[model samples]
Target: MTMMDALGLIENRSYLSSIVAADTALKAANVTLIDLEIIRGGYVTVKLIGDVGAVKAAVEAAKDAAESFGALISAHVIPRMHEETAKLIEKQKGRPAASPEGAKPTAKQEKEETGEQAKTEAVQEESPSPAATERNEENGQEKLTREQLEKLTVVKLRQLVRERKAMESATQINTAKKAELIHSLLEKMEKKE
Candidate 1:
C-alpha cells in the first residue's frame, strides 16, 4: 500500500481509525510501508492522536528515536486527537432530601398511609357495602340484598343490633326484630364453630 491510501483516510475524517492505528503500532510495534503517512512536503508523518501514552509513543516513532529495534522504523509523528469525554446528570422533581433522616417511618405513619390508600381504593367505584349506602332519609327504608346480609361481619352485626335497639322511631320495630332474629342465628353459627 502507498502513502496515498493512508492519506485518503484523512479525507473521510475517520478519527477512530487513527487511534486504532496508533494503538496497534504502540502495542505490537508493527512496522510496514502502509503504516507511514507520506506528507505533501516530502516528510513521512505517522499520526497518533489518542491518550497521553499513545501520543508519546507516536511522537517517538515519528522522530525515528523510538528505540523499538527494527520493529518500529521510519516517520514523523503528529498528535491531534483525544478520547471521548463522558458526563452524567441527574434530576429529581419530588424526592425528599433525607426522608425524615434515618428515623424510618413510625408504625402510625405506615398505618395512616395504608388507611389513605384504602380510602382511595374504596372511592374508585368498587362494590358498595350496605353501610356505604345508608337508608334514604326521606323514605326511612332500604331493601338490603341477601348477599349484603351474608357478607356482614360479627362486629357489623353487633353494631346493627345496637342501632336497632336504640331506635326511638316506633314504626321500624317489626323489620328490626326480623334482623335481630337473623343476627342471633348468625351469632349462634359463629359460636358453634
Candidate 2:
C-alpha cells in the first residue's frame, strides 16, 4: 500500500459547500476521499489523503471551489500524519485492511460488514432512548428535552460553548449556571437554523 504522505482538510459551514469541496478535491488530483464529517451546527469537514504534492493541489482547488458556495471555515494540510492519526482515520472510515491475510474475508466483504455495523449504530444513536421519554416514570434520569442539550455531559457542553461562541457571559459563571447559559444559547442557535 502506498503511504499517504499528506492529508488535506477543508471545513465549510454549509453541507452543499462541503460537497463542492469534495468534488473539486477528487477531480483535481489522484487523492483518496477520507471522509466528509458533519460537525455541529451544520458544519462539514472534507478530508483527502494522498502524496504531499497531490494533497496540496487538491486542497487549493477545494478551497477555491468551496469558497464560491459559502463561508470556507478552515483549510489545512498535514504533510506527514502520525501513525495514530492514520489509525483514527481508518477507524472513522471503517475501511478493511488493504490485504486480507490468512483465511480472512476479502476487502469487499469486510467493507460490507463494517458498513452494516455503522448503519445500525447510527440508527440506534439517532433515535431517542426509551428512558429519555415517559417523563412521569420515576426513572432517576430526566427526560430528553426538546433542546436535547440536557442529555450531553459537561465536557460536551463546554465543547459546544467553544464551537458556537454563543454565550460569552457563561464562561465566568459556575458549572450549573454555565450549563443553563449554554442551553439558552443553543436554543437560539437552533432557532436560527
The residue-level lDDT of candidate 1 at 55 comes to 44
lDDT at 50, model 1? 42
Superposition TM-score, candidate 2 onto the true structure: 0.49
Per-residue alpha-carbon lDDT of model 1 for 29-110, expressed as tens digits? 3333223354453333344334444445544443333333222334443233211111000001121222323768667557
For residues 1-193, what per-residue lDDT tens digits would candidate 2 score against the true structure? 2344688999999999999899999999999897999999999999999999999999999999988986699999988777667656776776643432366776777778998999898767755577665442443333345446655556556655665564565544235454675565456555544
TM-score of 1: 0.22
| Candidate 1 residue pairs that clash | 62-75
Q: After superposing candidate 1, which stretches have Cα over 4 Å from the reference? A: 1-98, 101-139, 166-193
lDDT for 114 in candidate 2 is: 90
Cα RMSD (Å) per model?
A: 27.3, 13.3
**Which residue window of length 10 is worst by lDDT in model 2?**
135-144
